[model samples]
Target: MKGMTIIVKTVSSWIKVLVFLFGIYIILFGHLTPGGGFSGGVILAGSYVLLLLAFGREYAEENLPLPIASKLDCIAAFLFIALALLGFIYGAGFFFYNFLQQELMADCNAAGKLVSAGAIPLYNIFIGLKVAASLFLVVLVLSAFRSESDPTEGQE
Candidate 1:
Protein backbone atom coordinates (compact mmCIF):
# COMPACT_ATOMS: atom_id res chain seq x y z
CA MET A 1 0.00 0.00 0.00
CA LYS A 2 2.93 2.35 0.41
CA GLY A 3 4.90 1.98 -2.81
CA MET A 4 4.42 2.23 -6.52
CA THR A 5 2.82 -0.34 -8.76
CA ILE A 6 4.09 -3.94 -8.88
CA ILE A 7 5.50 -3.41 -12.36
CA VAL A 8 7.64 -0.51 -11.18
CA LYS A 9 8.95 -2.43 -8.18
CA THR A 10 9.85 -5.44 -10.30
CA VAL A 11 11.64 -3.37 -12.90
CA SER A 12 13.54 -1.33 -10.38
CA SER A 13 14.55 -4.43 -8.43
CA TRP A 14 16.19 -5.74 -11.57
CA ILE A 15 17.69 -2.48 -12.76
CA LYS A 16 19.22 -1.47 -9.43
CA VAL A 17 21.77 -4.27 -9.66
CA LEU A 18 23.09 -3.06 -12.97
CA VAL A 19 23.22 0.47 -11.70
CA PHE A 20 25.18 -0.59 -8.66
CA LEU A 21 27.59 -2.59 -10.74
CA PHE A 22 28.17 0.26 -13.12
CA GLY A 23 28.94 2.50 -10.18
CA ILE A 24 31.56 0.07 -8.91
CA TYR A 25 33.08 -0.22 -12.36
CA ILE A 26 33.34 3.50 -12.64
CA ILE A 27 34.98 3.81 -9.25
CA LEU A 28 37.46 1.04 -9.95
CA PHE A 29 38.50 2.26 -13.38
CA GLY A 30 38.25 5.93 -12.67
CA HIS A 31 42.01 6.43 -12.76
CA LEU A 32 42.00 5.60 -16.46
CA THR A 33 38.53 6.73 -17.37
CA PRO A 34 36.57 9.96 -17.23
CA GLY A 35 34.04 9.00 -14.60
CA GLY A 36 35.44 8.97 -11.09
CA GLY A 37 34.42 8.72 -7.44
CA PHE A 38 31.95 11.58 -7.33
CA SER A 39 30.06 10.65 -10.46
CA GLY A 40 30.03 6.97 -9.62
CA GLY A 41 28.90 7.72 -6.09
CA VAL A 42 25.99 9.76 -7.42
CA ILE A 43 25.05 6.82 -9.61
CA LEU A 44 25.27 4.44 -6.66
CA ALA A 45 23.03 6.63 -4.53
CA GLY A 46 20.63 6.93 -7.43
CA SER A 47 20.23 3.16 -7.52
CA TYR A 48 19.08 3.19 -3.91
CA VAL A 49 16.88 6.18 -4.63
CA LEU A 50 15.25 4.13 -7.34
CA LEU A 51 14.58 1.41 -4.82
CA LEU A 52 13.16 3.94 -2.40
CA LEU A 53 10.82 5.33 -4.99
CA ALA A 54 9.64 1.92 -6.12
CA PHE A 55 9.32 0.18 -2.74
CA GLY A 56 8.81 3.03 -0.28
CA ARG A 57 11.01 4.33 2.51
CA GLU A 58 10.44 1.39 4.87
CA TYR A 59 11.60 -1.21 2.39
CA ALA A 60 14.60 0.86 1.33
CA GLU A 61 15.61 1.38 4.95
CA GLU A 62 15.30 -2.35 5.55
CA ASN A 63 17.68 -2.97 2.68
CA LEU A 64 20.24 -0.42 3.95
CA PRO A 65 19.72 0.53 7.53
CA LEU A 66 20.71 3.96 8.76
CA PRO A 67 23.18 2.60 11.27
CA ILE A 68 25.09 0.56 8.70
CA ALA A 69 25.19 3.39 6.20
CA SER A 70 26.32 5.83 8.87
CA LYS A 71 29.12 3.50 9.91
CA LEU A 72 30.26 3.03 6.35
CA ASP A 73 30.24 6.77 5.73
CA CYS A 74 32.34 7.47 8.78
CA ILE A 75 34.76 4.61 8.14
CA ALA A 76 35.34 5.59 4.54
CA ALA A 77 36.08 9.17 5.54
CA PHE A 78 38.57 8.09 8.17
CA LEU A 79 40.30 5.72 5.81
CA PHE A 80 40.57 8.37 3.11
CA ILE A 81 42.14 10.81 5.54
CA ALA A 82 44.53 8.17 6.82
CA LEU A 83 45.56 7.24 3.30
CA ALA A 84 46.31 10.89 2.48
CA LEU A 85 48.29 11.39 5.66
CA LEU A 86 50.35 8.31 4.92
CA GLY A 87 51.81 10.13 1.92
CA PHE A 88 53.39 12.67 4.26
CA ILE A 89 55.45 9.95 5.91
CA TYR A 90 56.30 7.91 2.81
CA GLY A 91 56.44 10.34 -0.10
CA ALA A 92 58.73 13.16 -1.26
CA GLY A 93 57.26 15.88 0.92
CA PHE A 94 53.65 15.92 -0.27
CA PHE A 95 50.16 14.71 0.57
CA PHE A 96 48.50 12.04 -1.63
CA TYR A 97 51.79 11.29 -3.41
CA ASN A 98 51.80 8.02 -5.30
CA PHE A 99 54.45 6.10 -3.40
CA LEU A 100 53.21 2.73 -4.59
CA GLN A 101 53.44 3.80 -8.20
CA GLN A 102 57.15 4.38 -7.81
CA GLU A 103 57.71 0.81 -6.72
CA LEU A 104 55.59 -0.55 -9.52
CA MET A 105 57.17 1.68 -12.16
CA ALA A 106 60.27 -0.52 -12.03
CA ASP A 107 58.31 -2.90 -14.25
CA CYS A 108 58.20 -1.79 -17.88
CA ASN A 109 54.64 -3.11 -18.37
CA ALA A 110 53.17 -1.43 -15.31
CA ALA A 111 52.31 1.81 -17.05
CA GLY A 112 48.59 1.17 -17.77
CA LYS A 113 47.87 -1.76 -15.51
CA LEU A 114 44.93 -1.54 -13.16
CA VAL A 115 47.13 -1.61 -10.05
CA SER A 116 49.64 0.82 -11.48
CA ALA A 117 47.68 3.85 -10.43
CA GLY A 118 48.62 3.20 -6.81
CA ALA A 119 46.71 5.44 -4.45
CA ILE A 120 44.27 6.74 -7.04
CA PRO A 121 42.07 3.68 -7.16
CA LEU A 122 42.04 3.37 -3.38
CA TYR A 123 41.11 7.02 -3.07
CA ASN A 124 38.37 6.56 -5.63
CA ILE A 125 36.97 3.57 -3.79
CA PHE A 126 36.83 5.34 -0.45
CA ILE A 127 35.47 8.54 -1.92
CA GLY A 128 32.83 6.61 -3.80
CA LEU A 129 31.70 4.84 -0.65
CA LYS A 130 31.61 8.02 1.39
CA VAL A 131 29.72 9.97 -1.24
CA ALA A 132 27.20 7.20 -1.83
CA ALA A 133 26.51 6.71 1.87
CA SER A 134 26.24 10.44 2.50
CA LEU A 135 23.85 10.99 -0.38
CA PHE A 136 21.72 7.99 0.55
CA LEU A 137 21.54 9.17 4.16
CA VAL A 138 20.38 12.58 3.05
CA VAL A 139 17.68 11.10 0.86
CA LEU A 140 16.57 8.59 3.45
CA VAL A 141 16.35 11.16 6.21
CA LEU A 142 14.45 13.55 4.01
CA SER A 143 11.96 10.84 3.08
CA ALA A 144 11.55 9.49 6.63
CA PHE A 145 9.67 12.44 8.02
CA ARG A 146 6.05 12.36 7.03
CA SER A 147 4.20 15.53 6.15
CA GLU A 148 1.14 16.65 8.08
CA SER A 149 -1.08 15.83 5.16
CA ASP A 150 0.39 12.38 4.55
CA PRO A 151 -2.33 9.78 4.15
CA THR A 152 -0.53 7.28 6.39
CA GLU A 153 0.14 9.83 9.14
CA GLY A 154 -2.25 8.14 11.61
CA GLN A 155 -2.09 4.61 10.34
CA GLU A 156 -0.64 1.78 12.40
Candidate 2:
Protein backbone atom coordinates (compact mmCIF):
# COMPACT_ATOMS: atom_id res chain seq x y z
CA MET A 1 0.00 0.00 0.00
CA LYS A 2 2.65 2.52 0.96
CA GLY A 3 5.49 1.24 -1.14
CA MET A 4 4.30 1.47 -4.71
CA THR A 5 3.24 4.58 -6.59
CA ILE A 6 -0.06 4.76 -8.51
CA ILE A 7 1.24 3.36 -11.83
CA VAL A 8 3.25 0.59 -10.16
CA LYS A 9 0.29 -0.28 -7.96
CA THR A 10 -2.01 -0.67 -10.90
CA VAL A 11 0.37 -2.94 -12.79
CA SER A 12 1.20 -4.99 -9.71
CA SER A 13 -2.45 -5.47 -8.85
CA TRP A 14 -3.11 -6.91 -12.29
CA ILE A 15 -0.07 -9.12 -12.00
CA LYS A 16 -1.15 -10.44 -8.64
CA VAL A 17 -4.59 -11.33 -10.00
CA LEU A 18 -3.05 -13.14 -12.94
CA VAL A 19 -0.65 -15.02 -10.71
CA PHE A 20 -3.45 -16.08 -8.39
CA LEU A 21 -5.51 -17.36 -11.27
CA PHE A 22 -2.57 -19.30 -12.62
CA GLY A 23 -2.01 -20.88 -9.24
CA ILE A 24 -5.63 -22.01 -9.10
CA TYR A 25 -5.39 -23.45 -12.57
CA ILE A 26 -2.31 -25.40 -11.59
CA ILE A 27 -3.98 -26.81 -8.48
CA LEU A 28 -7.14 -27.86 -10.35
CA PHE A 29 -5.33 -29.43 -13.27
CA GLY A 30 -2.79 -31.14 -11.10
CA HIS A 31 -4.72 -34.40 -11.26
CA LEU A 32 -4.73 -34.50 -15.06
CA THR A 33 -1.35 -32.85 -15.66
CA PRO A 34 2.24 -33.49 -14.71
CA GLY A 35 2.33 -30.83 -11.97
CA GLY A 36 0.83 -32.34 -8.85
CA GLY A 37 0.91 -31.57 -5.13
CA PHE A 38 4.27 -29.94 -4.50
CA SER A 39 4.47 -28.00 -7.74
CA GLY A 40 0.96 -26.68 -7.54
CA GLY A 41 1.35 -25.86 -3.87
CA VAL A 42 4.44 -23.83 -4.54
CA ILE A 43 2.67 -22.03 -7.33
CA LEU A 44 -0.17 -21.17 -4.98
CA ALA A 45 2.21 -19.87 -2.37
CA GLY A 46 3.99 -17.84 -4.99
CA SER A 47 0.76 -16.07 -5.74
CA TYR A 48 0.44 -15.08 -2.11
CA VAL A 49 3.94 -13.74 -2.20
CA LEU A 50 3.05 -11.77 -5.27
CA LEU A 51 0.15 -10.24 -3.43
CA LEU A 52 2.37 -9.34 -0.53
CA LEU A 53 4.88 -7.79 -2.84
CA ALA A 54 2.24 -5.85 -4.68
CA PHE A 55 0.19 -4.51 -1.79
CA GLY A 56 1.90 -5.16 1.56
CA ARG A 57 2.27 -7.71 4.32
CA GLU A 58 -0.67 -6.24 6.21
CA TYR A 59 -2.89 -6.65 3.17
CA ALA A 60 -1.79 -10.22 2.68
CA GLU A 61 -2.43 -11.08 6.34
CA GLU A 62 -5.84 -9.45 6.20
CA ASN A 63 -6.72 -11.49 3.12
CA LEU A 64 -5.35 -14.77 4.52
CA PRO A 65 -5.28 -15.05 8.26
CA LEU A 66 -2.45 -17.06 9.76
CA PRO A 67 -4.73 -19.07 12.04
CA ILE A 68 -6.95 -20.16 9.17
CA ALA A 69 -3.98 -20.98 6.99
CA SER A 70 -2.41 -23.04 9.75
CA LYS A 71 -5.59 -25.00 10.26
CA LEU A 72 -5.88 -25.68 6.55
CA ASP A 73 -2.31 -26.95 6.48
CA CYS A 74 -2.92 -29.30 9.39
CA ILE A 75 -6.16 -30.61 7.93
CA ALA A 76 -4.68 -31.22 4.50
CA ALA A 77 -1.76 -33.19 5.92
CA PHE A 78 -4.01 -35.23 8.17
CA LEU A 79 -6.33 -36.04 5.29
CA PHE A 80 -3.41 -37.19 3.13
CA ILE A 81 -2.10 -39.55 5.79
CA ALA A 82 -5.57 -40.81 6.57
CA LEU A 83 -6.26 -41.55 2.92
CA ALA A 84 -3.08 -43.60 2.70
CA LEU A 85 -4.04 -45.53 5.79
CA LEU A 86 -7.52 -46.19 4.45
CA GLY A 87 -5.98 -48.23 1.68
CA PHE A 88 -5.14 -50.94 4.20
CA ILE A 89 -8.79 -51.52 5.05
CA TYR A 90 -9.56 -52.21 1.39
CA GLY A 91 -6.97 -55.00 1.19
CA ALA A 92 -4.74 -52.78 -0.91
CA GLY A 93 -1.81 -53.54 1.40
CA PHE A 94 -0.80 -50.04 2.50
CA PHE A 95 -0.73 -47.91 -0.64
CA PHE A 96 -0.19 -51.04 -2.63
CA TYR A 97 -1.43 -51.69 -6.19
CA ASN A 98 -4.25 -49.18 -6.82
CA PHE A 99 -5.97 -50.50 -9.89
CA LEU A 100 -9.37 -52.14 -10.36
CA GLN A 101 -7.86 -55.47 -11.46
CA GLN A 102 -7.82 -56.60 -15.10
CA GLU A 103 -11.57 -57.17 -15.51
CA LEU A 104 -12.73 -53.83 -14.07
CA MET A 105 -9.79 -52.06 -15.65
CA ALA A 106 -10.90 -53.19 -19.10
CA ASP A 107 -14.41 -52.00 -18.47
CA CYS A 108 -13.19 -48.52 -17.66
CA ASN A 109 -10.95 -48.16 -20.69
CA ALA A 110 -8.61 -50.02 -22.97
CA ALA A 111 -5.71 -49.46 -20.63
CA GLY A 112 -7.34 -47.05 -18.20
CA LYS A 113 -6.25 -43.48 -17.54
CA LEU A 114 -4.02 -42.43 -14.68
CA VAL A 115 -6.92 -41.40 -12.47
CA SER A 116 -8.49 -44.81 -13.01
CA ALA A 117 -5.66 -46.19 -10.90
CA GLY A 118 -7.83 -45.45 -7.83
CA ALA A 119 -5.91 -44.57 -4.68
CA ILE A 120 -3.08 -42.96 -6.62
CA PRO A 121 -5.28 -40.12 -7.82
CA LEU A 122 -6.69 -39.65 -4.36
CA TYR A 123 -3.20 -39.50 -2.90
CA ASN A 124 -2.13 -36.98 -5.52
CA ILE A 125 -5.05 -34.73 -4.67
CA PHE A 126 -4.37 -35.04 -0.95
CA ILE A 127 -0.70 -34.34 -1.34
CA GLY A 128 -1.45 -31.36 -3.54
CA LEU A 129 -3.77 -29.85 -0.98
CA LYS A 130 -1.38 -30.57 1.87
CA VAL A 131 1.61 -29.09 0.10
CA ALA A 132 -0.30 -25.99 -0.99
CA ALA A 133 -1.64 -25.29 2.46
CA SER A 134 1.66 -25.96 4.18
CA LEU A 135 3.63 -23.78 1.82
CA PHE A 136 1.15 -20.93 2.09
CA LEU A 137 1.17 -21.14 5.86
CA VAL A 138 4.91 -21.06 6.00
CA VAL A 139 5.10 -18.04 3.75
CA LEU A 140 2.41 -16.16 5.61
CA VAL A 141 3.86 -16.89 9.04
CA LEU A 142 7.34 -15.93 8.05
CA SER A 143 6.17 -12.81 6.28
CA ALA A 144 4.03 -11.79 9.21
CA PHE A 145 6.88 -12.10 11.63
CA ARG A 146 9.20 -10.25 9.33
CA SER A 147 6.71 -7.46 8.95
CA GLU A 148 6.25 -7.17 12.69
CA SER A 149 9.97 -6.92 13.22
CA ASP A 150 10.26 -3.99 10.82
CA PRO A 151 7.39 -1.60 11.19
CA THR A 152 8.52 0.91 8.64
CA GLU A 153 8.81 -1.52 5.75
CA GLY A 154 5.80 -2.44 3.64
CA GLN A 155 6.66 -5.94 2.48
CA GLU A 156 9.55 -8.10 1.41
Model 1 weakest 10-residue run by lDDT = 103-112
| Candidate 1 residue lDDT tens string, 1-156 | 278998998999999999999999898888888898989999999999999999988888999999999999999999999989888877876798776667545464366567767788889999999999999999988786654457867785
Candidate 2: Cα lDDT at 97: 43
Provide backbone clash counts, one per model. 0, 1
Model 1, which residues run further than 4 Å from truth? Answer: 147-152
Pairs in steric clash, model 2: 37-128
Please provide, for model 2 over 55-126, each residue's C-alpha lDDT reduced to its tens digit, 9 standing for 90 to 100.
777787777787887887788778877766665665447564443443245466423345365455566666
lDDT of each: 0.87, 0.67
Candidate 2, residue 69: lDDT:
79
The best candidate by TM-score is 1
